[model samples]
Target: MQTLLKPSFTRETAFLKVKAAEDAWNRRSAILNQTLNTKMVRV
Candidate 1:
């Protein structure tokens, strides 16, 4: 049950949204890097 952050969010919600986005981005980047490294090693 997470709170939905909308355009009209308070300071705390804004920070939460930013942190969530950053964490997601970091996870994606890590997965992409690992995939690339595996392909490079196989080649």
Candidate 2:
């Protein structure tokens, strides 16, 4: 993760990496929210 901020990496590379990571986390968050909602409805 720190590699994304290292000076050795190009700006485009870092930007793309950050964007990809953000997208992945967003997807995970959505899934977690769905699971929590389902559990709450069951209760």
Candidate 3:
């Protein structure tokens, strides 16, 4: 009952955390990649 709900809730929280982290990483990566491309073009 309560124990089963706890596991599902915990999984949901963990998934949210992972998703947020992945989104942040992807944003940073895109910015860095764009900057690198511009620099490469200039060079």
* lDDT, model 1: 0.85
Scored against the true structure, residue 6 in model 1 reaches a CA lDDT of 67
lDDT comparing candidate 3 with the true structure: 0.78
Candidate 3 global TM-score: 0.58
Worst 10 residues of 2 by lDDT: 34-43
lDDT of 2 by residue, 9-39 (tens): 7989999999999999999998877853375
Show where candidate 1 strays beyond 4 Å.
Answer: 1-7, 36-43
Best by lDDT: 1
lDDT of 1 at 13: 91
Tell how far residue 13 is off in model 3, in angstroms. 0.4
lDDT of 3 by residue, 1-43 (tens): 3544345457778999999999999999988778533755453
Candidate 1, residues 6-41: lDDT per residue as tens digits? 677889999999999999999999887785337554
In angstroms, give how far residue 22 of model 1 lies from its true place. Answer: 0.3
Q: How accurate locally is residue 34 in candidate 2, as Cα lDDT from 0 to 100?
A: 81
